[model samples]
Target chain A: MTHASLALESALRQVAAEIDAQFDRLLDVPDDPRADLYRAMRHAAIGGGKRLRPLLVFATAQLFAVDKSCAARVATALECIHVYSLIHDDLPAMDDDDLRRGKPTVHKAFDEATAILAGDCLHDLAFELLAHEATHADPFVRVELISELARSSGPAGMAGGQMMDLEAEKASFDLATVTRLQALKTGALISCAVECGAILGRVPHEGRTGLRGYARDIGLAFQIVDDILDAEGDEALVGKKLGKDGAAGKETFLSLLGIDRAREQARMLVDQAIAHLHAFGPEADLLRDVARFTLERDR
Target chain B: MTHASLALESALRQVAAEIDAQFDRLLDVPDDPRADLYRAMRHAAIGGGKRLRPLLVFATAQLFAVDKSCAARVATALECIHVYSLIHDDLPAMDDDDLRRGKPTVHKAFDEATAILAGDCLHDLAFELLAHEATHADPFVRVELISELARSSGPAGMAGGQMMDLEAEKASFDLATVTRLQALKTGALISCAVECGAILGRVPHEGRTGLRGYARDIGLAFQIVDDILDAEGDEALVGKKLGKDGAAGKETFLSLLGIDRAREQARMLVDQAIAHLHAFGPEADLLRDVARFTLERDR
Candidate 1:
C-alpha cells in the first residue's frame, strides 16, 4: 500500500475508535422505561459506519492545532447528524432499506416508532453536544459551530438534497441539477465537517476560502464515487445495498456521465481538492490523502 | 373578560401574529425542485395552533425588558421545536393521527416521507434560529438557550417522555410514573419556552428559581388539563382526534385519579403555579393569567 493510503487507514481507524468511545459515554441508557429508546439511539449511533465526517473534523482540526477532545465532541455531533439522517432515510416511507452498515436498520432492529423517536432524539443530542462548554471554551465558537451545522443539515442542505433525490427518481435531471442535488444531499455535511474543524482552530475567513474550496471539490468527488459504487461496487464491501439508484432510475453522476466519465470526473475533483491544500505545507497531508482515498474507497 | 385575561388575550393575538409572519418569512419555499419539502415545513409550522409556547417566551421576556424582536426569534425557535414534535408524533407509525389543528396532518397533506423530512428540517431550523444574532445580543445567552433547548427536547426530556408514554400503552403506570412521563414528554419544551425567555432577559440564577418552580407547576397542570380535554373536549374544538390515550389504554392522570380528582388536581397545581410568582408584582400578572388559562382552555 502507498504511504498515503496507509496513513489514511490508520487515521480513519483512530478517529473511528475515538468517536465510538465518545458515543458510548454520551449515549448511556438509564435503567428506566425509556431504556428502549436509549438502546435504539445507542444502536443507531454507536454501531458501525465509515466515520468519514468525523475523520474530516479531526483532520481539519489538526491543521488548526486544536485539541483532540474538542475535535472529538464536534466529530461525535457530526456523526449523530449523519446517523440520524440515515435512520430516517431508511424508514419504510423513505428508502425502505432493511440494512445499514451491514446490519438491520434502526426501524428494522427496533420498531418503526422507536426508530423515529431515536432518530429525533439523536438529532437533538447532536446540538446538545455542540452547545456544551466542553465542545469549545468560547461561546462564540460554539454558536458558530451550531449555526453552521444546522444550516448545512437543514432545509437547504442534507434534507433538501434528499428531497431533490426523491424528485430525481421520478424525472431525469441534467448534470447541473444532479450536481446541485449531490452538493446538498451529501456535500453540505461533508463541507460542514471540515469547516467546523477550521472554526475550532480559529481559521480566519481568508484561510477558510481554501478549505471551503477543498471541501466543495471533494464533496462532489465523494458523491460521484458514491454513484459509482452504487452502480457497480460489491454490496458486502459497501455495507449497503448497491445499484438502488440505477434500479430506481435516479439521476446520478454515474447515470448522467457513465462509469468511465464519472470516474474521470471524480479523479479530476480529487486532484483539484488536493490542489486547494497546496497553500498549507505538510499540515494538510491527511486531508490530501483522504481526498485520494475517496476515489479509491469501495464503500 | 377580567383585566388579566383581556391583556393576555391581546398579547397572545399579537405574538401569534408576529410568529406566524416570522415563520412565513423563514419558511418560504424557494423556486426549486425541493420546494415541496419547504411547503411541507411551512404547512406544519404555519398551520393553526394556540401558539402557547411562543406566548410564554414573549411574556417571560417582557419581564426582563428584552427586545421584542429577540423574544420573537426565540419564541419562533421554540415554536419550531413544538411543531416538529407534533409532526413526528402524528406520524402513522407513532400516533397515526389524521388531523392536527383543524387540518390534515403533515403526512396527510404531503406524504409520510415529506412529513419526516419537514419535521427533521424544522428541528434543525430551531437550533439555527437560536444560534443567530437575532435571538440575542450575547453569544453566551444564545449558547445557553441552545443547550437548554437541546437538553429539554432530547432523550432525557421530550423523547424519553414519548418513549415512556409509548411503553405505557403496553403496561399500566402509576400516578408518579404518569407524572414523570408527562413532565418529560410535554413539560420539558413548555418549560423550555419560559426558560429561554428568562435566559434572553438575563435573569439572575436566584431570580430563575421562581421561574423554574413556576414552570414545573404549570407544566404538570398543562398535561393534566390535556388529559381532561382528551376525555371531555369537543372534537372540533380540540382540533384533533381525542381519547386516543384511553383507547390505547395508556395510563394518564385522568385514568389514575378519575375526572373529578384530575380536574381538582389540575386546579390545585394551577393555584400553586400562581403562588410561585408572588414575589413579583403585576409584571407577572400575564404569567398568572396563562396558568389559569391552561385549566380553562378547552383546546
Candidate 2:
C-alpha cells in the first residue's frame, strides 16, 4: 500500500476503535434473564471490522466542524443497521454462510433462531438509538438524522436493493438495472451516513446534495471492487470464502463486464466520487483517500 | 353452534370483508418493476384468515368515539406485521409449514427467497405507511403510531417472544414461561393495536390504560383458546393443518395445563378481558364482543 493510504487506514482504525468504545458504553444490558439476546446482539455488533460506515459518519461530521463525539449515537445506529444486515444475510434461510470477517457467522456461532432474532432486535435498536437522542445539539437536527436514516435503511433503500439483488441472481440485467439495484442495495446506506453526518453538522442543503453524490459513487465503486476481489482474491487473505459470487451465479458487475472494463469503470467512479468532494476543499481529504482505496484494496 | 356465536361469526365476516376492501384500495404499486414484490406482499397480507388485528384497531378507536377510518393506516400496518410474521414462520428454515389459513404458505406459493424478501419488504412498508400523513389525521399522531408499533413489534417485544417460542419448542416449559412467551408473541401486537388506536384518537391517558388492560386479557384468552383448538379442532374446519403444535413439540398453555384446565383458564381470561371494559360504558361493546367470541370459537 502507498504511504498515504497506510496513514488513512491508521487514522480510520483509531476513529473506528473510538466509535466501538462508545457503542459498548451505550449497550448497557438490563438484569432480565432475557438479557442473553442483548448480549448476543452486542457481541455480533462490537466484533471488529473496517468500520467504514461509522468512519464516514465521523469524518463527514468533522468536515462540517461538528464534534465527533456528538455524532456517536447516529454512527453507532448506522453500524447497527449494517451489522443487522450481516446477521440476517448470513442466516440459514438467507445466504447460509458460515464465515464472515474470519470469524464464524452469527448463525453459525450462535443458532439460526438466535441469529434471526438478533437481527430483528438490532434493526429495532438502530431506530431506538436514533429516536432516543441524548447528545444532539439541536432536536430538529436529530429528527432530520432519524428520518434520513429511516428512509435510507428502509424499503425504498438498502433493503429494497437487497431484494432486487436476490431477484437479479443469475438473471441477465442491463447496466441501468444493475445501477438502480446497487444504488439502493449498497449506495443508499453509504449516502445516508454522509447525509446524516452533514445534517448533524448543520451542513447546508447544497452541501448535503454534493456529499451524497460523493457517497453514491464511492459506494458503487466499493461494490465493484468487492466483485473483482471475489473473482480473484485468496480466501485466506480475504478472510471469508472467495468465489462464492461465481458459485452462486450472481449477476455481479465483473460478470456483466469483463475484468478490464470493470476495473476501468471502478476507477471512473472513484474519480467522480472525489470530484463531488471539491465543495469541501481540503476538509474532505480523507474521503478522497477512501474513494481511491475503494478501488485499490486487495481484499 | 350457539345462536349468539352464529351472530358473532356473521359480524366478524362482514367486518373482515370491509377491512379487506379498504386494504385493497390502499395497495399502490410503485413505478419500479420490483412493484410485483409489493403485490406479492399484498397477497400474503390480504385474502388471509379473519382480520382480527385490524378489527381490534377499529374497535379500539371506536371505544374513544373515533372513526374507524381514522386508524385505517395503523390497522393496515398491524396486519402487515402479523402477515409478515406468518410468512417468515412458514419458511423452510423455520417451521417449514406448507399451509396457512387453508392456503399454501407464502414460501410454498412463492419461492423461499421471494417469501423472505416479501417478509422483509412488508416490515419496512408497515413503517412507511405509518410515517405518511395520508394514513392518519395528524403528523404527530403518525409518529406516535410508528413509535408504539416499533415498541410492540421489536426486540423487547414480539420478536423477543418469538425467540422464547423457538427455545420452548421440544422443551418442557412451565406455565409462567408459556404465558410470558405468548404475551410477547401474540399479546404484544394485540395490546399495541388497541393502545395505538387510542393514541391516534387522542384518548385520555387513563382510558388508554384501561383499554390496554382489556386488550391484554383478550390477547391471552385468544392464545389459550388457540392452544385448546390445536388439540381439538379439525384441519378442514380450522382452515389450516391441525396438530401442528403437538407435531412440533411446542410448549403451550395446553401442553402445560392439559385441555380442560386450559379451557377453564381461557374462560377466566375472557371474563377478565370483558370486565376491564366496564369503565368505558357502551363505547367498548365491540371489544367485549371480540373477547367473548374469542373464547367461544370452535375452530
Candidate 3:
C-alpha cells in the first residue's frame, strides 16, 4: 500500500476505536428494564461497519484545525445517525435483513420492538449531542450544527431518499431518477458530514462552496461504488447479503451502466471530487484520500 | 359547565386550530415518491388527537409572557415527537394497533416502510424546528430547548419507557414498576411540554420549581386517567381499541389500584397539581384547568 492508503487506514482504525470507546462510556446498561434496549443499541452501534461517516467529519474538521474533542463529539453524533439508520433499515418491515455487519441484525438478535426503540433512541442521541455546549462553545455554532444535521437526515433528505429507494423496487428508474435517489439516500448525509465540519470550524456559507462540491461529487461516486459492490462484491467482505437489488430485480447504477461503465463513472467522479479541493493545502490531504478511497474501497 | 371549564374549552379549541394550521404549513406533500411519506406524517399528526401537549406548552409559556409564535413552534416540535412516538408505537412489531385518533394508523394508511420513514422524518423535524432561529432569537434558549426535548424523547426518557411498557406484556409489574414505566413513557413528554415553555420564557432554575412540580403531578394524573379510560371508556369516545392493557394482561394502575381507588388517586393528584400553581396568580388559571382536565378526560 502507498503512504496515502496507510494514512487513511490508520485514521480509520483510530476513529473506529474512538467511536467504540465513546459509545461504551455513553451507553452503560442500567439495572432496569431498559437494559435490553441499551444492549441492542450497543450491539448495533458499538463495534461495526466502515465508520466512513465519522471519518469524513474528522477529515474535514482537521482541515480547519478544529479541536479534537469537538471533532470527536461531532464524529460520534454522525456515527450515531448512520448506525441508527442501519438498525432501522435492517428491520423486518423494511429490508428484512437478518444479518448486519456480519452478525445477526438488531431485530434478529433482540426482538423487533427492542430494535425499533433502540433505533429511535439513537436517533434522539445524535441531536442531543449536537445541541449540547460540549460540541461547540458558541451556541450559534451548535444550533447551526443541529439544524444542518436535522435537515440532512429528515424527510427532505436522508429519509426522503430511503422512501424513494423503497419505491425504486416497484418503479423502473432511469439514470436521472437513479442519480436523484442516490443523492438523497446516501449523498445527503455524506455531504452533511463535510458541511458539519465546516460549521464546526465556523466556515462561512460562501467558504463552503468547494467543500460542498467535493462532497457532492464524492457522494455520487460513493453510491456508484455501492451499486457496483451490491452487484458483484463478496458477501463475506461486505458483511451482509449482496446482490439484493438484483434478486429483487431493482434498478441500480450497475444495472443501468454495466460494471465497466459504472466503474469508469465512479473513477471520473472521484477525480472531479479531488479537483474541488484545489484551494486546500496538505491540511486537506486526508479528504483527498477519502475521495479516492470512495472509488477504491471494496465494501 | 362552569365558567372555568368554558374558558379551558375555548382555549383547547383555539390551540387545536393553531396546531392543525401549523402542521398543515410544515408538512406539505412534495411532488415525488416521498409524497406518501409526508402524507402519512400528515395523517398521523394533523386533524387528530386532543392536542394536549401543545396546550401544556401554551399554558406554561403564557405565564411568563413568551412570544406566541415562539411558543407555537415549540408546541409543534413537542407534538412532532409525540406523533412520531405514536407512529412507532403502533407498528406491527410494537403495539400493532390498527386505529389511532379514529383514523387508520400510518402503517395501515400507507405501507410500513413509509410509516417508519414518516416517523423518523418527523423525529428529525422536531429538532430542526427547535434548532432554527425562527423558533427563538436566543441561541441559548434554542439549544436548551433542543437538549431538553432530546432528553425527554430519547432512550432514557420516552423511548426507554416504551421499552419497559413492552416488557410489561410479559412480566408482572407491581404498582411501583407500573408508575416508573408510565412516568417514562407518558409523563416524560407531558412534563417536557411544560418544561420547554419554561425554557422558552427564560425562567430560571429556581423559578421553575413550581412549574416542574405542577407538570410532574399532572403527567401522572394524565396516565392514571388513561388507565381508567382504557378499562371503561366507550370505543366511540376513546376513538380506538379499549381495554388493551387488560386484554394483553399488562399490569397498570387500574390493575394495582381498583377503579374507585384509581379515580380517587387521579382526583387527588389533580388537586395536588393545582396546588403547585400557588406561586402564580390568575395567569396560571389555564394550568389549573389543564390539571382538572387531566382527571376528567375520558380519552
Candidate 4:
C-alpha cells in the first residue's frame, strides 16, 4: 500500500478502537433481566465493519484542531446511529438478511423482538450521547450537532431514502432519482459527520461550505464504490451477500452507468472531493487520503 | 359531571384537537414515492388516544407561565414519541394488537414494513423537534429536553422496561418488580412530559422537585387505572382488547393488590399527587383535576 493508504488504514483502525471502547463503556451489560437486550445491542454495534463514518468525524475534527476525546463521543454516537440503521434495514420485515459482516444478523442471532428493541435502544443512545455535556463543553455546539444528526437521520433524510428504496423495487428509477436516493439514504449521514466536526471546531461559514462540498463528493463516491463492490467484489471480502442488488434488479450506479463508467465517475468524484480541501494544507491529508481510499476499498 | 370534571374534559378535548391539527400539518403526505410510509406515520400519530401526555405537558407548562405556542411544539413532540412507542409496541413481535383506539394498528392498516418504518421515522421526528429552535429559544434548554427525552426512551428507561416486561411473561414477578417495570415502561414518558414543560418554563430546581413528585404520583395512578380498566372495562369503550394481561398471567397492580386494593391505592396516589401541587393555586387547577381524572378515566 502507498503511504497515504497506509495512513488512512491506521486512522480507521484507531477510530474503530475508540468507538469500540466507548460502546463497551457506554453499554456494559448489567446483571439484570435486560442484560440480553444489552447483549443484542452490543452484538449489533460492537463487532465489525469499517468505521468510515466515525473516521470522517475524526478526520474532519482534526482539521480544526478539535480534541479527539470530544470527537470520540460524537463518533461513537454516529456509529450507533449507523449500526442501528443497519440492524433495522436487515430485519425480516425489511431486507430479511440473515447474514451481516459474515455473522448472523442481530435478528438471526437474537429474536426479532430483541433485535427491534436493540435497534430502538441504540437510536436513543446516539441522541443521548450527543445531548450529554461530555459531547461538547458548549451547549450550543452540542445542540447543533444533534440538530444536524437528527435532520440527516429523520424522515426527509436516511429514513426517507430507505422508504424510497423500498418503493424503488416495484419499478424502474432514473439516474437523478437514484442519485437523490443515495444522497438521502447514505449521503446525508456522511455529510452530517463532516459537518458535525466543523460544528465542533467552530469552522467559519465559508469553510463549512467548502467542507460540505468535500463531504458531498466523497459521499457519492463512497456509494458508487459500494455499488461496484457489491457487483464485482468477493462476498467473503465484502463480509455479506453481494450481487443481491443486481439479483433483485435494483438500479445501482453500476447497473445504470455500467462498471467502467461507474468506476470512472467514482475516481472523478474522489479527485473533486480532494480539490474541495485545497484551502487547507497537510492538516487535511487524512481527509484527502480517505477520499482516494473510498474508490479503492473493497468493502 | 362536577365543574372540575367538566373543565378537565373540555381542556382535554381542546388539546386533543390542537395535537391532531398539528400532526396533520407537520406530517402531510408528500407527493413522493414514499407516500405510503408517510401515510403509515400519519395513521399512527394523527387519529388516536386521549392525548393525555400532551395534556400533561400543556398543564405543567401552564404552571410556569410558558407560552402556549412553545408549549404546543413540545407537546407535539411528546405525543409523537408516545405514538411511536405505541406503534412499535403493537407490532406482531411485540404486543401484536390488531386494534388501537378502535382503529386498525399501523402494521395492520399498512404493511408491517411500512409500520416499522413509520414508527422509526416518528421517533426520529420527535428528537428532531426537540433539537429544533422552535422548541425553545435557549439551546441549553433544548439540549436538556433532548437529553431527558432520550434518557426516558432509551435502554435504561422505556426500552429497558420493555425488555423486562418481555422477560416477565415467562416467569412470575413480585409487586416491586412489576412496579418498576410499569414505572419504566409507562411512567418514564409521562414524567418526561411534565419535566419537559418545566424545562421549557425554566422552573427552578426546587420547584421541579415538587412537580416531579406530582408527576410520579399521577404516573403510577394512571397505570393502576389502566390495569383496572383492562381487567374490567368494556372492550368497546376501551377500544382495544381487554383482559389480555389476565390471559397472559402477567402480574399487574390489579393482579397483585386485587381490584378493591388497587382502586384504593390509585385514589391515595391521586390525593398525594394533588397535595404535592398544593403550593400552586387555581392556576394549577387543571393539573390537579387531571390527576383526579387519572383515577376516573375509563379508557
Candidate 5:
C-alpha cells in the first residue's frame, strides 16, 4: 500500500478505537432494566462499520489543529447519530436485517422495543454530547455543531433520504431524483462530519465552501461504491445482507448506470473530490486519500 | 370554576394554539416522497393532546416575564420531543396502538417506515429548534436547553423509563419500582418542560430547586391521573383506547396502590406540587391551578 493510503487506514483504526472508548465511558451500564437498552446501543455502536464519519471529523479537525480531545467528542457524537440511524434502519419495520457486522441486529440480539429505545437514546446522546460545554469552549460553536448535525440528520437530510429510498421501491426514479435522494440520505451527514471539524476550529461558514464541495463529491462516490459492493461484494466481507436493493426493486445508481459505468462514475467523483482540496498543502494529503479510499473500499 | 382554574384553562388553549401553529409552519410539506413523511409528522404533531408541556413552559416562563415568542419556540421544541416519543411508542414493535388523540396513529395513517422516519425526524427537529438562535439570545441558554432536553428524553430519562416499562411486562414491579418507572417515563419530560422555562429565564441551578420540586410532584401526580383515566375514563373522551395497561398486565400506580389510595396519593401530590411554589405569591396562581387541574383532568 502507498504511504498515504496506509496513513488513512491507521487513522481509521485510531478513530474507531477513540469512538469505542468514548462510548464505553459514556454508556456506562447501570444495574437496571435500562441495562439491556444500553447493551443494545453498545452492540450496534461500539465496534462496527468503517467509522468513516468519525474519521472525517478527525481528518478535517486535524487540518485546523483543533484539540484532539474536543474533536474526539464531536467525532463520537457524529458516530452516535450514524449508529442510531443504522439501528432504526435495521428494525423489523424498516430493513429487517438480522445481521450487522456479522452479529445479530439490535432487535434480534435484544428485543424490538429495546432496539427502538436504544436508537432513540443514541440520537439523544449525540445532541447531548455536542451541546456539552466540553465539546467546545464556546457555546456558540457547540450550538452550531448541534444545529448542523440536526439539519443533516433530520427529515430534510438523512431520514428524508431514507424516506425517499423506501419510496423508490414503488416508483421509478430518474437519475436526478436518485441523486437528490442520495444527497439527503447518506450525503448530508457525511458532509456534516467534515464541516463539524471546521466549525470546531472556528472556521467561518464562508471559508468552508471547498471543504463542503470535497465532502459532497466523496459522499456520492462513497454511496456509489456502497451500491457496487452490495451488488457484487462478498457477503462475508460486507457483513450484512446484500443485493436486497435489486431484489426489492429499489432504484439505485448501480441499477441505473450498470456496474461498469457506476464504477467509472465513482472514480470521477473521487478525482473531483480531491480537486476541491487544491488550495491545501501536504496537510490535506490525508483528505485526498480519503476521497480515493471512498471508491476503493471493499465494505 | 374558580378564577385561578379559569385562567389555567385559557392558558392551555393559548399554548396549544401556539404550538399547533408553530408545527404547522415548521412542517410545511414539499412535493416529494418525503411529503408523506412530513404529512405523517403533521398529522401527529400539529394538533391534539393537552399541550401540558407547552403550558408548563409558558406558565413558568411567565414567572420571569420571558419573551412570549422565545417561550413559544422552546415550548414547541419540547412538544416536538413529546410527540416524537408518542409516534415511536405507538409503533407495532412497541405499544402497537392504532389510535392516538382520537385519530389513527402515524403508523396507521402512513406506512410503518414512514412513521419511523417521521418519529426520527421529529426527534432531530427538536434539537434543531432548540439550537436555533431565535430560541434564546444567549448561546449558553440554547445549549443548556438542548442538553437538558437530551438528558430528559434519552435512555436515562424517558427512553430509559420506557425500557423499564417494557421489562415490567415480564417482571412484577413493586411500589418503588413503579414510582421510578413513572418518574422516568412520563415524569422526566413533564419536569423538563417546567425546567426549560426556568432555563429560558436564566434561572440559576440553585434557584431552580423549588421549581424542580414543583415539576417532580406534578409529574408524579400527572402519571397517577393518567393511570386513573386509563382505568375509568370514557374512550370517546380520552381519545385513545383505554385500559391497555390492565390487558398488558403492566404494574402501574393503580395496580400497586389500588384505585382509592392512588386517588388519595394523586391528591396529596397535587397539594404538595402547589406547596413547592409557596414563595412565589400571586404570580404563581396559574401554576397552582395547573397542579390542581392535574388530578381533576379526565383526559
Candidate 6:
C-alpha cells in the first residue's frame, strides 16, 4: 500500500479499536441483579469490524480539522444505531441468520427474547446518548441530528426499505424499485454518516451540499458492490453464508441487473461521488480514497 | 353501569376516539413511493386498546384543571409508545401470539418484517410528535417527556424487565423476583403514564411522587390480577389464546403463590395503590377507581 493508503488504513484501524474500547466501556455489564440485560446489550454491540460509521465521522470531521474528541460521542451513537439494526435484522422472524460477522447472531448467542430487548435497548441508548446535554452541540443541532437519524432509520427510511424489499421478494422488480429499496435499506445510514460528518465539521452551506451528494453517491455504490459481492464473493472472506439473499428470494441489485450491469452502475456512481469532492481541494483526498475504498473493499 | 361508572366510561371512550382521530390527522401518507410505509404504520397503531394511557394523561391534566389542548399531543404520544411495544411483543420472534384485543396481531395480520418496521416507525413517530413544539407542551417539558419515556422503555426499565421475565421462565422465581421483573417490564410505562399526566398537569413534585407511587402499586396489582385471571379465565373473555405462560414455564404470581394467595396480594396492592392517591384529595378519585378496576376488571 502507498503511504496515503496506509494512513487511511491505519486511521480506520485506530477507529475500529477506539470504537470497540469506548463501546466496551459504555456497555460494561453492571453488577445489578438484572445485569443479564446489560450483558446481552453489550454482547450485541461490542467488537464489530471496521467501525465504518465512526470512521466516516472521523474522516468527515478531519476534512474541516474538527477535533476527534468532538466527534467521538456521536460516532459511538452512530454505531449504536447500526448495531441495533443488525440485531433486529438477525432475529428469527427476520433473516433468521444464526451467525453475524462469523459469530453467533445475538439471538443465537443469547435467547430470542433477550436479543429482541437488547436491540430495543440499543435503539434507545442511541437517542439517549444524543439527548445528553454533555454532548454539547447546539440544542437545535442536537434536535436536528436526532430527528435526521430517526427519520433515516425509522419507517420512512431503513425500516421502510426493508419492508419494501420483503414485499418485493422474488417478484421481478424493476431497476427503479430495486434501486429505491437499496437506497433506503443500505444507503440511508451511509448518507447520514456523511451528513453528520459535515454537521460535525461545521461545513459551510455550499460545501455541505457537496459533501452530502458525495456521501449519497458513494453510499448507493457501496450497496451495489455489496449486492455484487453477495453473488460472487467468498464465504470465508465475507464472514457470512454467501448467496443467502438469493436463497431467501430477496430483491437485490445483482438479482435485478446482473453482476456486469451492477458493476457498471457502481463505477458510474463512484465517478459522480468523487466529483462532489473536487471543491474540497487536497484536504478531501482521504474522502476520495474512502469513496474508492467503499466500492473496492472485499468484505 | 352505575351513573359514575357510565360517566367515566363515556368520557374515556371519547378520549380514546379523540386521540385516534388526532393521530390520524398528524399522519401524512406521501404519494406512491413511501405511501405503503405510512399506511402500514397507521394500520398498526390506529386500531388498538381502550387508550388507557391517553385517558390517564387527559384525566391527570383534568385533575389540575389544565386546558385540554395542553396535554392532548402527549396523550397521543403515550399511546404511540404503548402501541409500538404491543406490535413488537407480538412478533413471531417474541411472544408470537396471533391474537390481541380479539384480532390478529400485527405480524399475523401483516408480514413479520412489516410488523417489525411498523413498530420501529411507530416509535419514531412518537418521538417526532413530542418534538413538535407546536403540538403540545413546552420544549423543556417535551424534552423531559421524551427522556423519561426513553429511559422507562429502554434497558434498566421495560426492556430490562422483559429480559428478566424471559429468564424467569423455566425457573421458580420468588415473590421478590416476580415483583422486580413486573416493576421494570410492566410497571415502568404505567408509572410513566401517571407521572406524565402529572407533569403535563404541572403538578408539584410531591404530587408527582405520590402519583408515581400510585401508578407503580396499581401497575403491579394489575399484573397480579392478570396472572390470576390467566389461571382461571376463559380464553373467549380474554380475547386471546391463553395458558401458554404456564406451558412455557413462565413465572407469575398465581403460578408461584397459587391463585387464592395471588388474589389476596392483588387486593392488598390495590389498597396501597389507592392510598397514594390521597395526596391529591378528591381530584384523584378517578385514579382510585382505575386502581380498583385493575383488580376487578373481568377482562
Q: TM for chain B in all models?
A: 0.98, 0.92, 0.98, 0.97, 0.98, 0.93
Model 4 agreement with the true structure over A52-169: per-residue lDDT tens digits: 8999999999988998899999999899889989988999888889888888999999888888899999999999999999889899898889988988987888888998888888
lDDT (10s digit) by residue, model 3, range B187-294: 999999999999999999999998988998899989998988898887787788888999999999999999999989998988998998998999999999999988
Question: Which regions of candidate 1 are displaced past 4 Å?
Answer: A1-4, B1-4
Comparison by lDDT, 1 against 2, better one = 1
Kindly list the per-residue Cα lDDT of model 4 for residues B219-253, writing each as its tens digit: 99999999999989888878899888988888899
In candidate 2, what are the lDDT values of residues B61-172, reduced to their tens digit? 8766666566777788888788877887777766778888888888788677667767766676676676665666555566567667877887667887887777777567
TM-score of each: 0.98, 0.90, 0.99, 0.97, 0.98, 0.90
TM-score of the A chain in candidate 6: the value is 0.94
Q: Per-residue CA lDDT of candidate 1, range B1-299, in tens? A: 23347887898789879988999999887998899998998888885898989999988999889899999999999999999999999999999999999999999999999999999999999999999988887899999999999999988899889989889988888999999999999999989999998998998777898888889999999999999889888999889999898899888999899999999999999999999888889998989989998888888
lDDT string for model 5 (B32-96, tens) is 88899999999999879989999999999999999999999999999999999999999888899
lDDT of 5 by residue, A80-184 (tens): 999999999998889899999878899999988888899999999999999998999999999999999999999889999999989998999999999999999
- For model 1, what TM-score does chain A reach? 0.98
lDDT of 2 at B52: 81
Weakest 10 consecutive residues, lDDT, candidate 6 chain B? B1-10
Question: Which portions of model 3 miss their true places by more than 4 Å?
Answer: A1-4, B1-4
CA lDDT, every prediction? 0.91, 0.77, 0.92, 0.89, 0.92, 0.76
> Model 6, B67: alpha-carbon shift in Å?
5.6
Please, what are the lDDT tens digits per residue for candidate 6 over residues A154-178?
8667877776676675466688888
Interface RMSD of each: 0.6, 2.8, 0.6, 0.8, 0.6, 2.1
A-chain TM-score of every model: 0.98, 0.94, 0.98, 0.97, 0.98, 0.94
DockQ of 2: 0.30
Put the candidates in DockQ order, highest first: 5, 3, 1, 4, 6, 2
Model 6 agreement with the true structure over B1-299: per-residue lDDT tens digits: 22236556776678878887876886678764556667766776675566777877777777888677767887887787778788888876677889887788877776776677777777777666766665443555655666677788888688778777767765677888889989988888888787777777667676577777788888899888778767777776677778877888887888888888888989999899888777677777777777777887766
